[model samples]
Target chain A: MTYVTDVPEMAVAPAGGPPGHGAVPAADTPTQWAAAYFDGYSTVGLLAVVGVLFLTVAFVGGRLLRPVVPTPEKLLTYECGVDPVGEGWAHTQVRYYVYAFLYVIFAVDSIFLFPWATVFAEPGFGGTTLVEMFVFLGFLTVGLLYAWKKGVLEWT
Target chain B: MNDTLEVALRLLAVFVIFLVLPLVIGQTEHKVMAHMQGRLGPMYAGGFHGWAQLVADGVKFAQKEDVVPANADRRVFQLAPAVALLPYLLVLVAIPIGPDNAVGEAIDAGIFFVLAVMGVGVLGSLMAGWASANKFSLLGGLRTAAQLLAYELPMLLTAASVAMAAGTVSLPGMLDAFEWWWVPWQIVGGVVFFVAGLAELQRPPFDAPVADSEIIFGAYTEYTGLRFALFLLAEYAGIVVLSGLTAVLFLGGWHGPFADELGWLWTLLKTLALAFVVIWLRATYPRLREDQLQKLAWTVLIPLALAQIALTGVVKVAIS
Candidate 1:
C-alpha cells in the first residue's frame, strides 16, 4: 500500500490499457454534452425542453384567452354568504383536526406496512423486514395508545 | 413515419377514453340514476334521455361568467382547475386502460405508480379550497385531505396483497400470473380498495368534501363559469378514473370470461360495470358522518386490512 502518494492529474496519465475493458479516458466538453443531452443521439435534451415549452404555451394561452368579465354579483363569495356566528372560523373545536392528524400518521404507517409485509416473506428479507415492521408498529401502537388513553378514539 | 403515426393514433385513442368517456359516463350515470329513482333524468337535451346534454353543458360552462371573490387569492384560485385536471391526465401516463397495460411494455410497478399519482389530485382541491378564502372552502379542502389520508392506505394495502399473490407489479405480469382471474386472491383488498376508492373520489358515504347540506358545495363554493365546470367535469371524470382504477387493480382488466383475448370492448364493458356500481352506491347510500367515516377507516377498515396483510403473508408462505 502506498501510504503517502500525490494524485496525478488527467493531463499526465497515458491512454489505453486492456482491450474490451472500459478505460477512464479524458472526456471533451462537447462530447460530454452530446452524451448527456441527446441520450447519445442527436439531442435528447431537446425533447424535454420542447415538452416544457408546449406546456408553457398551453397554460399561458389558456390563461390569456379565457373569457373573463368581472361583474358585481359574480364577485361575491358563494353559499349565500352566511355570516359565521359565534367566534367565526377560528372558534371551532380542535378535536376533529387532532383526530385527522393522528389518523394520517397511522394511515401512512399502515401504507408502508403492506409493502414491508410483501418483502418480509422473501428468503433474505423476511427477518430484517419483520424486525423493522415490529419496531415500526411499536411507534404506531404508542400513538394509538396515546389516543385511546386520551379518549380521542371515542366519538360523542 | 410509421412509428410516429402509431404513437399519434395511440394518443388519440387515449384521449378518446380519458377526455371523452367521462362525458359519456356523466350522461349515462344521470340517466341510470334517474331511471333507478323512477324519474326521467333528461329527455330534452338532445335525443332520448338527453344524449346531447354534455355538449349543451360544455357550451354553457364555457359561456358562463368567470367569478373571483374580493378576498380570494388569485394565483392559487386560478391554478386550481388546471392543477386538478393534470393529475387525472398524469395517471393516464401509467395506467393500463386496454389489454397490454401499454406504456411501451407495462412495467411491474404500475399499481404503486398509479396510487402515487392519485394522491396528487387532492393537492389541487386543497389549493382550490384554501384560495377561495371562505371558511367553508377551507374546511372542504381540509376534509379532502383527511378523506384521502383515510382511504389511501386501505387501497395501497389491497394492491400490495394482489401484487404479492400475483408475484409481480406489472399489470400484464399480474394478468399472466393469474390468467384465470386476479379477483379471488384479493377479495378482501378489493372490497376495501373499492370503498377506499369511493372516499378517494369523494363519492357518497365519503362525500365530505362536497357535503352540500353542511359545507355548501365544499371546496368549489367560489368557482363559477368554465372554472367551476372544469371542477365539475373533474369530479365525474374522477369517478370514471376511480372506477377504472378499481377495475384494473382488482378485476383483471381486459381479461374477460371468454377465450384469452382483450379488446377495447372488454375494457369498456368492465369499466362501465364498475362505474355503474359507483353510481349505484351514490344512489343508495347516505353520506357518512365525518367522524364516523374517520372512525370506520381507522378502527375497522385499517385493522381489517392489517389482518388481511398478515393473512396474505401467511398464506403465501404456507403455499410456497
Candidate 2:
C-alpha cells in the first residue's frame, strides 16, 4: 500500500515548486528517506530468496522422484562418447580478457550516465548537463575509436 | 503486521507470475516455431496443440536420472542454474503491470537496478561452463562472457536513452511521464535494446555461445534431467524479462485506451507480442558466426545506441 517515490525527483525539488504539494518536505529525515529507498531493494532481495526456494523445491522434488543411478560411463564428462581430452580448464583466447577490460571501462561510464540521465533535463540543469555529458562521451568515443583502430574490438 | 502481510502477498503474486509466464512463452515458442517450419509441434501433449507440453516436459525431466558428471565442480555446477534463474525473477519484481501501485516493488533507480541485476545472469552460464569440466562447456562459458561484454554496452546505452527521455530512472515514473511521441523518438534505442537483450539471453542469431553444432550446447553440455531443464527455463524467463522491459521502456508500459482499468492487459499484450517476435526471429534467422556476433554488437549496435542517446538529449532540450 505504501508507494515508493522516485528519490532523485523528490531530492532535487524543482525550481519553483511550493513545499508539501508534491515536493518532499524538509521534515522528512534522511534516515526515513534511506529506509524507504532500501525497502524497495529489500523486496527485490526477498523475491530473489523466494526464487531460490522455488528452485530448491523443484530440485528436491526431482531428487525424490528421479533415479540417481550413476555408472562409470554415465558419470563421465561427455565428449561424444570418447573420454575428455586433457583438462576442462583449457587456456582460452586472450581476446576475451580484452573485451572484459573494455567492458569494465564502458560499464563504469554507463553507470555514471544513469544519474546524469536522471538529472540532465531538470529545470535548472538542462543545457549545462548536456554539454558536460557530451564532453564525457567524447572522451569515451576516443577510447572506443582507439580500440577499433588497434583491432582490439575485432573478435578474431 | 499489516505491512508484512502486504509484502508477503505481493511476493507471492510475483512468484506466481515468475513461474507462469516463462512456461507460457516456452509453449508459445514451440507452437509458433512448429507452424512456421510447417510441422505440427507437440499436437497431442496436452490433448490440444500441446498446451501442456512444457508441463509434461517438466514432469519427464523430473523423472529422468539426475546426472552430475564425475569431473564437474559439483557445487558450482549445481548452483549455476539458480544464479541464472533468480535474476530474471528479481527484475520482474520491479516491472510495473499497471498504473499507480501496480508494480511488485517500485525501486527508486529501477532502470539501473534492472540493468545491473540482468547483467549478473550471464555469470551463471560462465559458472556452468567453468564447473562442467567439459571442453565444450568451457568454450561455451568463455564465449558467453565475451558476448555479454560485447552486447551489454548497447543494452545499457539504449536503456539510458529511455531514462533520459523520461527524465527519471524508475519504470513506473517513465510510464507516468510517457507521451505518444516517444515510440518514434526511442524506436532506435528500443530495437537496439531488444536485439542486445536477445543476444544477452543467447537466443538464436547471437547464440554462438550455445550453438550445439559447434560447442554441443556450450555451458550446458554436461547437464541432464531437471538441471538441464532449469537452464532452459532460465532462457525462457530471460525472454519474458527482455520482452517486458522492451514494452515498458519503448512501446509504452501499460498505456492504452481505458488505461486506468485495462493497463495491465496492455502491458501483457505488448510483452507477449514481443515474445512472439523473439520466437519469430529464431525461426527466421540462422545463427551468426562468433566474429559476426561480436562485430554486430561493437560495430553496429553500440554506435547506434550512442547516437540514440545523443538524439534523446537533443530532443529533450528542443522540446523543453
**Against the hidden reference, what TM-scores do the models get?**
0.80, 0.94
Docking quality level of the chain pair in candidate 2: medium
Q: What fraction of the native alpha-carbon contacts across the interface, defined at 8 angstroms, is recovered by model 1?
A: 0.20
Q: What TM-score describes the B chain of model 1?
A: 0.94
- How high is the CA lDDT of each candidate model? 0.67, 0.88
For residues B1-320, write the lDDT of model 2, one tens digit per residue: 87689889989988888889999999988889999999989888878877998999998999999888888999999999889888999999999999987899888899988998999999899999999999999989988988898899999999999989988888988999999999999999999999999999999988999999999999999989898998999999999999999999999989999999999999999999999999999999999998998889888998899889989998898788
List RMSD in Å for every model shown. Answer: 8.2, 4.6
> Candidate 1, residue A59: CA error in Å?
8.0
lDDT at A7, model 1? 16
lDDT of 1 by residue, B219-283 (tens): 88888777787787777778777877776767766676551455545656778898889889889
Q: Score the docking of each candidate (DockQ).
A: 0.15, 0.51
**Alpha carbon lDDT of residue B157, candidate 1?**
69
